[model samples]
Target: MQCHQTSFTLSTAGRGPLRLTARVAECVRDSGIHTGLCHVFCQHTSASLLITENADPAVLRDLEGHLTRAVPDGDPRYTHDQEGPDDMSAHIRSILTGSGLTVPIRQGRLALGTWQGLFLWEHRAQGHARTLVVTCFGTAAS
Candidate 1:
Protein backbone atom coordinates (compact mmCIF):
# COMPACT_ATOMS: atom_id res chain seq x y z
CA MET A 1 0.00 0.00 0.00
CA GLN A 2 1.15 3.52 -0.81
CA CYS A 3 -0.09 6.91 0.30
CA HIS A 4 0.57 10.28 -1.26
CA GLN A 5 -0.67 13.70 -0.30
CA THR A 6 -0.59 17.11 -1.93
CA SER A 7 -2.36 20.43 -1.85
CA PHE A 8 -3.37 23.37 -3.99
CA THR A 9 -4.54 26.90 -3.44
CA LEU A 10 -7.36 28.64 -5.27
CA SER A 11 -7.93 32.35 -5.43
CA THR A 12 -11.66 32.59 -5.74
CA ALA A 13 -13.52 35.49 -7.30
CA GLY A 14 -16.34 34.92 -4.84
CA ARG A 15 -19.84 33.42 -4.87
CA GLY A 16 -19.55 30.68 -7.50
CA PRO A 17 -18.12 27.33 -8.48
CA LEU A 18 -14.62 26.94 -9.86
CA ARG A 19 -13.92 23.68 -11.59
CA LEU A 20 -10.70 21.95 -10.54
CA THR A 21 -11.03 18.55 -12.09
CA ALA A 22 -7.95 18.73 -14.26
CA ARG A 23 -5.73 19.94 -11.49
CA VAL A 24 -6.74 17.05 -9.27
CA ALA A 25 -6.21 14.57 -12.06
CA GLU A 26 -2.68 15.82 -12.44
CA CYS A 27 -2.06 15.18 -8.77
CA VAL A 28 -3.51 11.69 -8.95
CA ARG A 29 -1.49 10.84 -12.00
CA ASP A 30 1.67 12.04 -10.34
CA SER A 31 0.94 10.20 -7.12
CA GLY A 32 1.68 6.83 -8.83
CA ILE A 33 -1.32 5.27 -7.15
CA HIS A 34 -2.80 3.13 -9.88
CA THR A 35 -5.91 2.17 -7.94
CA GLY A 36 -6.94 4.14 -4.94
CA LEU A 37 -9.15 6.87 -3.48
CA CYS A 38 -8.72 10.58 -3.85
CA HIS A 39 -9.92 12.67 -0.96
CA VAL A 40 -9.95 16.45 -1.35
CA PHE A 41 -10.68 18.60 1.67
CA CYS A 42 -11.32 22.30 1.87
CA GLN A 43 -9.53 24.00 4.74
CA HIS A 44 -12.09 26.70 5.26
CA THR A 45 -15.50 27.04 6.87
CA SER A 46 -16.92 29.51 4.36
CA ALA A 47 -16.09 27.48 1.27
CA SER A 48 -16.95 23.97 0.13
CA LEU A 49 -16.38 21.27 -2.48
CA LEU A 50 -18.68 19.34 -4.80
CA ILE A 51 -18.74 16.99 -7.76
CA THR A 52 -21.43 18.20 -10.14
CA GLU A 53 -22.09 18.61 -13.83
CA ASN A 54 -19.32 20.46 -15.59
CA ALA A 55 -20.73 20.29 -19.11
CA ASP A 56 -23.28 23.05 -18.88
CA PRO A 57 -22.66 26.57 -17.70
CA ALA A 58 -26.32 26.94 -16.83
CA VAL A 59 -26.15 24.06 -14.39
CA LEU A 60 -23.52 25.83 -12.32
CA ARG A 61 -25.40 29.13 -12.58
CA ASP A 62 -28.64 27.58 -11.44
CA LEU A 63 -27.00 25.73 -8.57
CA GLU A 64 -25.37 28.93 -7.41
CA GLY A 65 -28.67 30.76 -7.71
CA HIS A 66 -30.49 28.13 -5.70
CA LEU A 67 -27.90 28.22 -2.97
CA THR A 68 -28.11 31.99 -2.81
CA ARG A 69 -31.87 31.89 -2.43
CA ALA A 70 -31.74 29.12 0.14
CA VAL A 71 -29.14 30.97 2.21
CA PRO A 72 -29.30 34.60 1.38
CA ASP A 73 -26.83 36.94 3.04
CA GLY A 74 -27.61 39.66 5.57
CA ASP A 75 -30.45 37.69 7.08
CA PRO A 76 -31.76 39.23 10.27
CA ARG A 77 -31.76 35.91 12.09
CA TYR A 78 -27.98 35.55 11.88
CA THR A 79 -25.94 37.11 14.70
CA HIS A 80 -22.43 36.07 13.71
CA ASP A 81 -21.72 39.14 11.67
CA GLN A 82 -18.16 39.57 12.85
CA GLU A 83 -16.83 38.97 9.36
CA GLY A 84 -19.64 40.81 7.57
CA PRO A 85 -23.20 40.10 6.50
CA ASP A 86 -22.13 37.10 4.44
CA ASP A 87 -20.16 35.42 7.22
CA MET A 88 -22.92 33.29 8.71
CA SER A 89 -24.56 32.85 5.36
CA ALA A 90 -21.30 31.53 3.95
CA HIS A 91 -21.00 29.01 6.75
CA ILE A 92 -24.57 27.87 6.16
CA ARG A 93 -23.95 27.39 2.47
CA SER A 94 -20.78 25.44 3.15
CA ILE A 95 -22.63 23.13 5.51
CA LEU A 96 -25.43 22.64 3.01
CA THR A 97 -22.99 21.79 0.25
CA GLY A 98 -19.93 20.10 1.76
CA SER A 99 -16.40 20.60 3.01
CA GLY A 100 -14.73 17.85 1.03
CA LEU A 101 -15.19 15.28 -1.75
CA THR A 102 -13.94 11.76 -2.27
CA VAL A 103 -13.54 10.22 -5.72
CA PRO A 104 -12.40 6.82 -6.83
CA ILE A 105 -9.19 6.43 -8.79
CA ARG A 106 -8.58 3.91 -11.54
CA GLN A 107 -5.56 3.59 -13.82
CA GLY A 108 -4.13 6.58 -12.02
CA ARG A 109 -7.06 8.74 -13.03
CA LEU A 110 -10.24 9.88 -11.44
CA ALA A 111 -13.12 7.49 -12.02
CA LEU A 112 -15.70 10.19 -12.40
CA GLY A 113 -18.76 10.28 -14.58
CA THR A 114 -18.37 12.08 -17.89
CA TRP A 115 -20.28 15.10 -16.65
CA GLN A 116 -19.10 15.00 -13.07
CA GLY A 117 -16.39 17.50 -12.19
CA LEU A 118 -14.75 18.71 -9.03
CA PHE A 119 -15.62 22.23 -7.97
CA LEU A 120 -14.73 24.66 -5.24
CA TRP A 121 -17.80 26.60 -4.20
CA GLU A 122 -17.03 29.98 -2.73
CA HIS A 123 -19.71 31.31 -0.44
CA ARG A 124 -18.27 34.66 0.52
CA ALA A 125 -19.10 37.89 -1.25
CA GLN A 126 -15.44 38.84 -1.45
CA GLY A 127 -12.58 36.87 -2.90
CA HIS A 128 -10.15 34.86 -0.78
CA ALA A 129 -7.35 32.41 -1.35
CA ARG A 130 -8.71 29.00 -0.34
CA THR A 131 -6.48 26.02 0.23
CA LEU A 132 -7.42 22.41 -0.50
CA VAL A 133 -5.55 19.36 0.76
CA VAL A 134 -5.68 16.29 -1.47
CA THR A 135 -4.75 12.84 -0.19
CA CYS A 136 -4.34 9.82 -2.46
CA PHE A 137 -3.92 6.31 -1.11
CA GLY A 138 -3.69 2.88 -2.73
CA THR A 139 -1.35 0.26 -4.15
CA ALA A 140 1.10 1.12 -6.91
CA ALA A 141 1.51 -1.18 -9.86
CA SER A 142 4.75 -3.18 -9.66
Candidate 2:
Protein backbone atom coordinates (compact mmCIF):
# COMPACT_ATOMS: atom_id res chain seq x y z
CA MET A 1 0.00 0.00 0.00
CA GLN A 2 1.01 3.58 -0.63
CA CYS A 3 0.32 6.68 1.44
CA HIS A 4 0.86 10.38 0.93
CA GLN A 5 -0.27 13.61 2.51
CA THR A 6 0.16 17.32 1.89
CA SER A 7 -1.20 20.73 2.74
CA PHE A 8 -1.90 23.88 0.75
CA THR A 9 -3.02 27.40 1.48
CA LEU A 10 -5.54 29.47 -0.46
CA SER A 11 -5.91 33.22 -0.25
CA THR A 12 -9.58 34.00 -0.59
CA ALA A 13 -10.77 37.39 -1.79
CA GLY A 14 -14.06 37.28 0.10
CA ARG A 15 -17.17 35.23 0.71
CA GLY A 16 -17.66 32.76 -2.13
CA PRO A 17 -17.00 29.23 -3.33
CA LEU A 18 -13.42 28.89 -4.55
CA ARG A 19 -13.02 25.93 -6.80
CA LEU A 20 -10.13 23.65 -5.86
CA THR A 21 -10.71 20.71 -8.13
CA ALA A 22 -7.51 20.99 -10.12
CA ARG A 23 -5.44 21.63 -7.03
CA VAL A 24 -6.81 18.60 -5.24
CA ALA A 25 -6.44 16.51 -8.37
CA GLU A 26 -2.80 17.52 -8.53
CA CYS A 27 -2.39 16.26 -5.00
CA VAL A 28 -3.98 12.95 -5.89
CA ARG A 29 -1.75 12.65 -8.94
CA ASP A 30 1.34 13.19 -6.85
CA SER A 31 0.32 10.70 -4.17
CA GLY A 32 0.97 7.57 -6.26
CA ILE A 33 -1.99 5.98 -4.54
CA HIS A 34 -3.88 4.46 -7.40
CA THR A 35 -6.92 3.32 -5.49
CA GLY A 36 -7.81 4.78 -2.12
CA LEU A 37 -9.61 7.42 -0.20
CA CYS A 38 -8.43 11.03 -0.17
CA HIS A 39 -9.33 13.06 2.84
CA VAL A 40 -9.35 16.83 2.42
CA PHE A 41 -9.69 19.00 5.50
CA CYS A 42 -9.96 22.73 6.02
CA GLN A 43 -8.18 23.94 9.16
CA HIS A 44 -10.46 26.78 10.00
CA THR A 45 -13.63 27.35 11.95
CA SER A 46 -15.10 29.93 9.61
CA ALA A 47 -14.44 28.12 6.37
CA SER A 48 -15.47 24.75 4.97
CA LEU A 49 -15.14 22.30 2.08
CA LEU A 50 -17.88 21.12 -0.23
CA ILE A 51 -18.29 18.99 -3.36
CA THR A 52 -20.91 20.18 -5.76
CA GLU A 53 -21.75 20.87 -9.40
CA ASN A 54 -19.01 22.15 -11.67
CA ALA A 55 -21.02 22.26 -14.84
CA ASP A 56 -22.72 25.57 -14.11
CA PRO A 57 -21.80 28.54 -12.02
CA ALA A 58 -25.40 29.11 -10.98
CA VAL A 59 -25.38 26.04 -8.77
CA LEU A 60 -22.52 27.43 -6.72
CA ARG A 61 -24.09 30.87 -6.57
CA ASP A 62 -27.44 29.52 -5.39
CA LEU A 63 -25.82 27.49 -2.64
CA GLU A 64 -23.98 30.52 -1.33
CA GLY A 65 -27.08 32.66 -1.61
CA HIS A 66 -29.11 30.14 0.32
CA LEU A 67 -26.55 29.95 3.09
CA THR A 68 -26.24 33.71 3.32
CA ARG A 69 -29.99 34.11 3.63
CA ALA A 70 -30.26 31.24 6.06
CA VAL A 71 -27.76 32.97 8.35
CA PRO A 72 -27.53 36.66 7.77
CA ASP A 73 -24.91 38.88 9.39
CA GLY A 74 -25.48 41.67 11.93
CA ASP A 75 -28.20 39.67 13.56
CA PRO A 76 -27.44 41.50 16.85
CA ARG A 77 -28.42 38.33 18.64
CA TYR A 78 -24.91 36.99 18.41
CA THR A 79 -22.53 38.15 21.10
CA HIS A 80 -19.37 36.72 19.61
CA ASP A 81 -18.86 39.43 17.05
CA GLN A 82 -15.42 40.52 18.16
CA GLU A 83 -14.20 39.79 14.67
CA GLY A 84 -17.20 41.59 13.20
CA PRO A 85 -20.79 40.72 12.36
CA ASP A 86 -19.66 37.82 10.22
CA ASP A 87 -17.71 36.06 12.97
CA MET A 88 -20.47 33.97 14.47
CA SER A 89 -22.31 33.67 11.19
CA ALA A 90 -19.19 32.30 9.56
CA HIS A 91 -18.96 29.59 12.19
CA ILE A 92 -22.61 28.78 11.73
CA ARG A 93 -22.20 28.46 7.98
CA SER A 94 -19.26 26.19 8.46
CA ILE A 95 -21.31 24.04 10.77
CA LEU A 96 -24.14 23.93 8.25
CA THR A 97 -21.69 22.75 5.60
CA GLY A 98 -18.59 20.96 6.86
CA SER A 99 -14.86 21.26 7.51
CA GLY A 100 -13.59 18.36 5.44
CA LEU A 101 -14.36 15.93 2.62
CA THR A 102 -13.47 12.40 1.58
CA VAL A 103 -13.22 11.43 -2.10
CA PRO A 104 -12.16 8.26 -3.77
CA ILE A 105 -8.94 8.16 -5.77
CA ARG A 106 -8.80 5.90 -8.77
CA GLN A 107 -6.07 5.57 -11.39
CA GLY A 108 -4.12 8.14 -9.47
CA ARG A 109 -6.87 10.68 -9.94
CA LEU A 110 -9.80 11.95 -7.97
CA ALA A 111 -12.87 9.92 -8.87
CA LEU A 112 -15.19 12.87 -8.98
CA GLY A 113 -18.29 12.82 -11.11
CA THR A 114 -18.26 14.50 -14.52
CA TRP A 115 -19.68 17.68 -13.06
CA GLN A 116 -18.39 17.48 -9.54
CA GLY A 117 -15.87 19.91 -8.14
CA LEU A 118 -14.33 20.54 -4.78
CA PHE A 119 -14.66 24.00 -3.32
CA LEU A 120 -13.45 26.07 -0.39
CA TRP A 121 -16.43 28.04 0.81
CA GLU A 122 -15.22 31.13 2.56
CA HIS A 123 -17.85 32.52 4.91
CA ARG A 124 -16.11 35.67 6.09
CA ALA A 125 -16.59 39.12 4.67
CA GLN A 126 -12.86 39.76 4.53
CA GLY A 127 -10.12 37.90 2.81
CA HIS A 128 -7.89 35.46 4.68
CA ALA A 129 -5.55 32.62 4.02
CA ARG A 130 -7.21 29.21 4.33
CA THR A 131 -5.25 26.01 4.84
CA LEU A 132 -6.21 22.63 3.46
CA VAL A 133 -4.75 19.24 4.36
CA VAL A 134 -5.04 16.38 1.88
CA THR A 135 -4.16 12.81 2.84
CA CYS A 136 -4.36 9.82 0.48
CA PHE A 137 -3.36 6.20 1.05
CA GLY A 138 -3.82 3.08 -1.02
CA THR A 139 -2.16 0.54 -3.28
CA ALA A 140 0.48 1.61 -5.75
CA ALA A 141 -0.34 1.64 -9.42
CA SER A 142 0.63 -1.52 -11.27
Candidate 3:
Protein backbone atom coordinates (compact mmCIF):
# COMPACT_ATOMS: atom_id res chain seq x y z
CA MET A 1 0.00 0.00 0.00
CA GLN A 2 1.07 3.56 -0.63
CA CYS A 3 0.07 6.91 0.83
CA HIS A 4 0.34 10.34 -0.71
CA GLN A 5 -0.80 13.73 0.60
CA THR A 6 -0.71 17.33 -0.50
CA SER A 7 -2.17 20.74 0.26
CA PHE A 8 -3.18 23.68 -1.86
CA THR A 9 -4.65 27.14 -1.39
CA LEU A 10 -7.62 28.51 -3.26
CA SER A 11 -8.98 32.03 -3.37
CA THR A 12 -12.74 32.27 -3.18
CA ALA A 13 -14.54 35.20 -4.78
CA GLY A 14 -17.07 35.27 -2.02
CA ARG A 15 -19.81 33.16 -0.58
CA GLY A 16 -20.39 30.39 -3.07
CA PRO A 17 -19.29 26.97 -4.21
CA LEU A 18 -16.10 26.68 -6.23
CA ARG A 19 -15.43 23.69 -8.42
CA LEU A 20 -12.58 21.49 -7.20
CA THR A 21 -12.99 18.27 -9.08
CA ALA A 22 -10.26 18.84 -11.60
CA ARG A 23 -7.83 20.11 -9.04
CA VAL A 24 -8.46 17.18 -6.74
CA ALA A 25 -8.24 14.81 -9.67
CA GLU A 26 -4.83 16.18 -10.40
CA CYS A 27 -3.77 15.26 -6.91
CA VAL A 28 -5.11 11.75 -7.34
CA ARG A 29 -3.14 11.36 -10.53
CA ASP A 30 -0.02 12.69 -8.87
CA SER A 31 -0.41 10.34 -5.96
CA GLY A 32 -0.01 7.29 -8.21
CA ILE A 33 -2.34 5.31 -6.04
CA HIS A 34 -4.28 2.98 -8.26
CA THR A 35 -6.99 1.90 -5.84
CA GLY A 36 -8.16 3.13 -2.48
CA LEU A 37 -9.71 6.15 -0.80
CA CYS A 38 -9.10 9.83 -1.35
CA HIS A 39 -9.79 12.05 1.61
CA VAL A 40 -10.29 15.79 1.18
CA PHE A 41 -10.33 18.16 4.09
CA CYS A 42 -10.79 21.90 4.48
CA GLN A 43 -8.84 23.41 7.34
CA HIS A 44 -11.41 26.04 8.22
CA THR A 45 -14.61 26.37 10.14
CA SER A 46 -16.30 28.86 7.82
CA ALA A 47 -15.98 26.73 4.70
CA SER A 48 -16.88 23.20 3.69
CA LEU A 49 -16.53 20.48 1.07
CA LEU A 50 -19.17 18.55 -0.80
CA ILE A 51 -20.00 16.49 -3.88
CA THR A 52 -22.79 17.88 -6.04
CA GLU A 53 -24.11 18.10 -9.57
CA ASN A 54 -21.80 19.56 -12.16
CA ALA A 55 -24.20 19.53 -15.11
CA ASP A 56 -26.38 22.54 -14.26
CA PRO A 57 -25.58 25.97 -12.88
CA ALA A 58 -29.17 26.25 -11.70
CA VAL A 59 -28.62 23.45 -9.25
CA LEU A 60 -25.81 25.39 -7.61
CA ARG A 61 -27.94 28.50 -7.51
CA ASP A 62 -30.76 26.61 -5.88
CA LEU A 63 -28.38 25.18 -3.31
CA GLU A 64 -27.10 28.63 -2.50
CA GLY A 65 -30.65 29.92 -2.26
CA HIS A 66 -31.58 27.14 0.11
CA LEU A 67 -28.62 27.84 2.31
CA THR A 68 -29.36 31.55 2.30
CA ARG A 69 -32.88 30.88 3.47
CA ALA A 70 -31.82 28.34 6.00
CA VAL A 71 -28.96 30.36 7.45
CA PRO A 72 -29.45 34.03 6.87
CA ASP A 73 -26.71 36.43 7.86
CA GLY A 74 -27.21 39.32 10.25
CA ASP A 75 -30.27 37.56 11.63
CA PRO A 76 -29.75 39.28 14.98
CA ARG A 77 -29.80 35.85 16.58
CA TYR A 78 -26.07 35.19 16.47
CA THR A 79 -23.42 36.75 18.72
CA HIS A 80 -20.20 35.69 17.06
CA ASP A 81 -20.11 38.40 14.45
CA GLN A 82 -16.58 39.62 15.07
CA GLU A 83 -15.76 39.25 11.39
CA GLY A 84 -19.05 40.78 10.34
CA PRO A 85 -22.62 39.50 10.24
CA ASP A 86 -21.66 36.51 8.14
CA ASP A 87 -19.23 35.18 10.73
CA MET A 88 -21.47 32.94 12.74
CA SER A 89 -23.61 32.20 9.74
CA ALA A 90 -20.56 30.98 7.89
CA HIS A 91 -19.67 28.68 10.73
CA ILE A 92 -23.20 27.36 10.78
CA ARG A 93 -23.14 26.69 7.10
CA SER A 94 -19.88 24.85 7.37
CA ILE A 95 -21.27 22.67 10.14
CA LEU A 96 -24.43 22.02 8.19
CA THR A 97 -22.39 20.80 5.25
CA GLY A 98 -19.00 19.41 6.32
CA SER A 99 -15.28 20.05 6.38
CA GLY A 100 -14.11 16.83 4.82
CA LEU A 101 -15.02 14.30 2.15
CA THR A 102 -13.95 10.82 1.15
CA VAL A 103 -14.17 9.55 -2.39
CA PRO A 104 -13.21 6.26 -3.91
CA ILE A 105 -10.30 6.09 -6.32
CA ARG A 106 -9.93 3.47 -9.01
CA GLN A 107 -7.43 3.03 -11.81
CA GLY A 108 -5.51 6.03 -10.52
CA ARG A 109 -8.49 8.31 -10.87
CA LEU A 110 -11.50 9.55 -8.98
CA ALA A 111 -14.53 7.29 -9.29
CA LEU A 112 -17.02 10.13 -9.42
CA GLY A 113 -20.22 9.83 -11.35
CA THR A 114 -20.62 11.44 -14.73
CA TRP A 115 -22.24 14.56 -13.35
CA GLN A 116 -20.66 14.54 -9.95
CA GLY A 117 -18.31 17.35 -8.99
CA LEU A 118 -16.39 18.25 -5.91
CA PHE A 119 -16.71 21.77 -4.54
CA LEU A 120 -15.51 24.01 -1.79
CA TRP A 121 -18.38 26.02 -0.34
CA GLU A 122 -17.35 29.36 1.06
CA HIS A 123 -19.85 30.78 3.50
CA ARG A 124 -18.39 34.18 4.15
CA ALA A 125 -19.65 37.40 2.60
CA GLN A 126 -16.17 38.48 1.55
CA GLY A 127 -13.52 36.76 -0.47
CA HIS A 128 -10.86 34.81 1.38
CA ALA A 129 -8.14 32.25 0.90
CA ARG A 130 -8.89 28.67 1.87
CA THR A 131 -6.59 25.70 2.21
CA LEU A 132 -7.39 22.13 1.36
CA VAL A 133 -5.50 18.96 2.19
CA VAL A 134 -5.93 15.87 0.06
CA THR A 135 -4.66 12.45 1.02
CA CYS A 136 -4.65 9.45 -1.28
CA PHE A 137 -4.01 6.06 0.25
CA GLY A 138 -4.06 2.59 -1.21
CA THR A 139 -2.22 0.30 -3.57
CA ALA A 140 0.42 1.67 -5.88
CA ALA A 141 0.36 0.85 -9.54
CA SER A 142 2.43 -2.15 -10.58
Candidate 4:
Protein backbone atom coordinates (compact mmCIF):
# COMPACT_ATOMS: atom_id res chain seq x y z
CA MET A 1 0.00 0.00 0.00
CA GLN A 2 1.09 3.54 -0.69
CA CYS A 3 0.03 6.87 0.70
CA HIS A 4 0.56 10.31 -0.78
CA GLN A 5 -0.45 13.73 0.48
CA THR A 6 -0.67 17.14 -1.13
CA SER A 7 -2.31 20.49 -0.48
CA PHE A 8 -3.32 23.65 -2.33
CA THR A 9 -4.52 27.12 -1.42
CA LEU A 10 -7.51 28.77 -3.11
CA SER A 11 -8.33 32.42 -2.79
CA THR A 12 -12.10 32.65 -2.78
CA ALA A 13 -14.22 35.66 -3.65
CA GLY A 14 -16.51 35.76 -0.68
CA ARG A 15 -19.35 33.32 0.02
CA GLY A 16 -19.99 30.68 -2.62
CA PRO A 17 -18.96 27.24 -3.84
CA LEU A 18 -15.62 27.00 -5.60
CA ARG A 19 -15.23 24.00 -7.86
CA LEU A 20 -11.98 22.18 -7.15
CA THR A 21 -12.30 18.97 -9.07
CA ALA A 22 -9.62 19.78 -11.60
CA ARG A 23 -7.13 20.83 -8.95
CA VAL A 24 -7.75 17.65 -6.99
CA ALA A 25 -7.37 15.53 -10.09
CA GLU A 26 -4.02 17.21 -10.77
CA CYS A 27 -2.84 16.28 -7.31
CA VAL A 28 -3.99 12.68 -7.68
CA ARG A 29 -2.15 12.38 -10.98
CA ASP A 30 1.00 13.82 -9.47
CA SER A 31 0.77 11.46 -6.51
CA GLY A 32 1.19 8.40 -8.76
CA ILE A 33 -1.66 6.58 -7.02
CA HIS A 34 -3.27 4.80 -9.93
CA THR A 35 -6.05 3.04 -8.04
CA GLY A 36 -7.04 4.29 -4.62
CA LEU A 37 -9.24 6.38 -2.43
CA CYS A 38 -8.78 10.13 -2.37
CA HIS A 39 -9.73 12.20 0.59
CA VAL A 40 -10.25 15.94 0.17
CA PHE A 41 -10.53 18.08 3.26
CA CYS A 42 -10.92 21.77 3.94
CA GLN A 43 -8.91 22.97 6.93
CA HIS A 44 -11.33 25.58 8.21
CA THR A 45 -14.21 25.83 10.57
CA SER A 46 -16.09 28.38 8.50
CA ALA A 47 -15.95 26.37 5.30
CA SER A 48 -17.10 22.98 4.04
CA LEU A 49 -16.63 20.40 1.29
CA LEU A 50 -19.27 19.12 -1.08
CA ILE A 51 -19.72 16.91 -4.12
CA THR A 52 -22.34 18.63 -6.25
CA GLU A 53 -23.61 19.03 -9.77
CA ASN A 54 -21.02 20.44 -12.15
CA ALA A 55 -23.12 20.54 -15.27
CA ASP A 56 -25.10 23.62 -14.41
CA PRO A 57 -24.35 26.91 -12.69
CA ALA A 58 -27.98 27.22 -11.66
CA VAL A 59 -27.59 24.23 -9.37
CA LEU A 60 -24.83 25.95 -7.43
CA ARG A 61 -26.81 29.18 -7.28
CA ASP A 62 -29.85 27.35 -5.99
CA LEU A 63 -27.76 25.54 -3.40
CA GLU A 64 -26.32 28.79 -2.14
CA GLY A 65 -29.76 30.31 -2.02
CA HIS A 66 -31.09 27.39 -0.03
CA LEU A 67 -28.25 27.53 2.43
CA THR A 68 -28.74 31.23 2.96
CA ARG A 69 -32.45 30.74 3.56
CA ALA A 70 -31.83 27.80 5.86
CA VAL A 71 -29.25 29.66 7.91
CA PRO A 72 -29.70 33.34 7.45
CA ASP A 73 -27.01 35.73 8.62
CA GLY A 74 -27.69 38.51 11.13
CA ASP A 75 -30.35 36.46 12.84
CA PRO A 76 -29.66 38.32 16.10
CA ARG A 77 -30.41 35.08 17.94
CA TYR A 78 -26.82 33.90 17.62
CA THR A 79 -24.58 34.68 20.59
CA HIS A 80 -21.23 34.41 18.84
CA ASP A 81 -21.17 37.61 16.84
CA GLN A 82 -17.71 38.90 17.55
CA GLU A 83 -16.87 38.91 13.86
CA GLY A 84 -20.15 40.46 12.81
CA PRO A 85 -23.32 38.96 11.29
CA ASP A 86 -21.63 36.51 8.99
CA ASP A 87 -19.44 35.01 11.72
CA MET A 88 -21.77 32.66 13.56
CA SER A 89 -23.76 31.94 10.44
CA ALA A 90 -20.60 30.79 8.71
CA HIS A 91 -19.88 28.36 11.49
CA ILE A 92 -23.44 27.09 11.40
CA ARG A 93 -23.28 26.53 7.67
CA SER A 94 -20.05 24.64 8.03
CA ILE A 95 -21.58 22.45 10.70
CA LEU A 96 -24.62 21.73 8.56
CA THR A 97 -22.43 20.68 5.67
CA GLY A 98 -18.96 19.18 6.29
CA SER A 99 -15.25 19.68 5.78
CA GLY A 100 -14.20 16.52 4.04
CA LEU A 101 -15.01 14.41 0.99
CA THR A 102 -13.89 10.96 -0.15
CA VAL A 103 -13.79 9.82 -3.79
CA PRO A 104 -12.62 6.69 -5.47
CA ILE A 105 -9.79 6.76 -7.99
CA ARG A 106 -9.72 4.29 -10.88
CA GLN A 107 -7.33 4.16 -13.79
CA GLY A 108 -5.67 7.31 -12.49
CA ARG A 109 -8.95 9.22 -12.65
CA LEU A 110 -11.67 10.13 -10.23
CA ALA A 111 -14.59 7.72 -10.45
CA LEU A 112 -17.17 10.45 -10.36
CA GLY A 113 -20.29 10.73 -12.43
CA THR A 114 -20.21 13.06 -15.43
CA TRP A 115 -22.19 15.75 -13.69
CA GLN A 116 -20.60 15.46 -10.26
CA GLY A 117 -17.76 17.67 -9.10
CA LEU A 118 -16.05 18.43 -5.82
CA PHE A 119 -16.39 21.90 -4.32
CA LEU A 120 -15.06 23.97 -1.46
CA TRP A 121 -17.94 25.80 0.13
CA GLU A 122 -16.83 29.09 1.59
CA HIS A 123 -19.37 30.47 3.99
CA ARG A 124 -17.53 33.57 4.98
CA ALA A 125 -18.54 36.94 3.56
CA GLN A 126 -15.01 38.02 2.85
CA GLY A 127 -12.50 36.57 0.46
CA HIS A 128 -9.63 34.65 1.96
CA ALA A 129 -7.15 31.94 1.21
CA ARG A 130 -8.48 28.46 1.92
CA THR A 131 -6.31 25.39 2.25
CA LEU A 132 -7.40 22.07 0.75
CA VAL A 133 -5.61 18.84 1.61
CA VAL A 134 -5.70 15.85 -0.72
CA THR A 135 -4.56 12.48 0.53
CA CYS A 136 -4.37 9.35 -1.57
CA PHE A 137 -4.12 5.85 -0.15
CA GLY A 138 -4.03 2.58 -2.03
CA THR A 139 -1.92 -0.27 -3.33
CA ALA A 140 0.89 0.60 -5.73
CA ALA A 141 1.19 -1.86 -8.55
CA SER A 142 3.98 -4.40 -8.06
Against the unseen true structure, what C-alpha lDDT does each candidate score? 0.94, 0.94, 0.97, 0.92
Model 3 stretches with alpha carbons more than 4 Å out: none
lDDT of 4 by residue, 9-115 (tens): 99999999998998999988888888999999899999999999999999999999999999999997999989889999999999899989999999888899999
Model 1 quality (TM-score): 0.98
Candidate 1 regions exceeding 4 Å error are none
Q: Model 3 — TM-score against the truth?
A: 0.99
lDDT of 1 by residue, 1-142 (tens): 9999999898999889988999999999989999989999999999999999989999999998998899999999999999999999999999999998999999889999989999999999999999999999998977
Best by lDDT: 3
For residue 42, what is the lDDT in candidate 2? 99
Ranking, TM-score, top scorer first: 3, 1, 2, 4
lDDT of 2 by residue, 23-46 (tens): 999999888899999999999999
RMSD for all candidates, in order, please.
0.6, 0.7, 0.6, 0.9
Q: What lDDT is reached at residue 73 by model 4?
A: 96
Which tens-of-lDDT digit does each residue in 24-136 have in candidate 3?
Answer: 99999999999999999999999999999999999999999999999999989898999999999999999999999999999999999999999999999888999999999
Give each model a TM-score: 0.98, 0.97, 0.99, 0.97
